[model samples]
Target: MRSSVPGTAKKFPLHPGHPERICWGCDKYCPASDMACGNGSSRTQHPAEIFGDDWFEPDPGADDAGAGREG
Candidate 1:
């Protein structure tokens, strides 16, 4: 059965290293290179795997570094 709630898949970047292989269907992290959830029904896929390494790039001119903030 399809879920009525819109589900957002957790995105794992490859830059930091050792991106975990987690099941988007559930909360368990499957590291065995196999589907460990839903009896091989849901496929596990990372954001970088589908959209390339720069998939999660920051917004342009967003000023996220707190450039003018005082201590």
Candidate 2:
């Protein structure tokens, strides 16, 4: 059998396993299956998300690589 409290919101369990990750940019709660900005902080959120690889270090080589690959 199941149990419930009077007038309380229905409480349901998530999946078997999951992680609660919040999006620093949107301030929305994201699940494990979702993606979270690696460099989330008070300084910037979108910057880290838009530029994942270069978030740590602004590599000049990245720009040159893109320029060379362009048609």
Candidate 3:
């Protein structure tokens, strides 16, 4: 199924070659200098920048099986 909102269905790159050159704030993928969202003065940094190269990888310590479940 496709997303109802525009640009929301686009596949985001897990490891963009130049993450800093583009704005990760929205699906527009606008250049860092030109943010289409107009929500902030500065461009949002890609997750890879703050979380490192393994940003998409699951955390080994996270207990996925127990998430949202009560004992």
Candidate 4:
């Protein structure tokens, strides 16, 4: 199970190939186009949404596409 200190938060990127704009931030997988748990706010988005596609690049050897953060 995923564990973290309370009050702390983490962000996950949207899966690149999802047909619908789905949120990868948590296990919920809420769709960006029709967010059910967003409470009017768009579900957590990837840096690429605010920045550009190049905002985060995939690591050459890493298996997961959104494995790292730029800090």
- Among all windows of 10 consecutive residues in model 4, the one with the lowest summed lDDT is 11-20
The C-alpha TM-scores of every prediction are 0.39, 0.21, 0.73, 0.35
Q: For residue 65, what is the lDDT in candidate 4? A: 60
Global fold similarity of model 1 (TM-score): 0.39
Model 1, stretches more than 4 Å misplaced? 1-24, 32-34, 39-42, 59-71
Model 3 per-residue lDDT tens digits across residues 1-71: 35667766677789999999988887678899878888589888999999999989998868786788888
- Indicate the residue-level lDDT of 35 in model 4: 69
Q: Model 2, range 2-54, lDDT digits (tens) per residue? A: 33766554333332122233333343333434646443433233344455534
The candidate that wins on TM-score is: 3
**CA-RMSD of model 1:** 10.9
lDDT of 4 by residue, 1-71 (tens): 23376555543543355423766455566777766665546566655666666666765777766568665
RMSD of each: 10.9, 16.1, 4.7, 9.9
Give the least accurate 10-residue stretch of model 2, judged by summed lDDT: 12-21
lDDT of 4: 0.58
Alpha-carbon lDDT, every model: 0.57, 0.42, 0.84, 0.58
Residue-wise lDDT of candidate 1 within 1-71, one digit each (tens)? 33355684444334534444554445465653676665476556666666767768875667867778898
Q: What's the TM for model 3?
A: 0.73
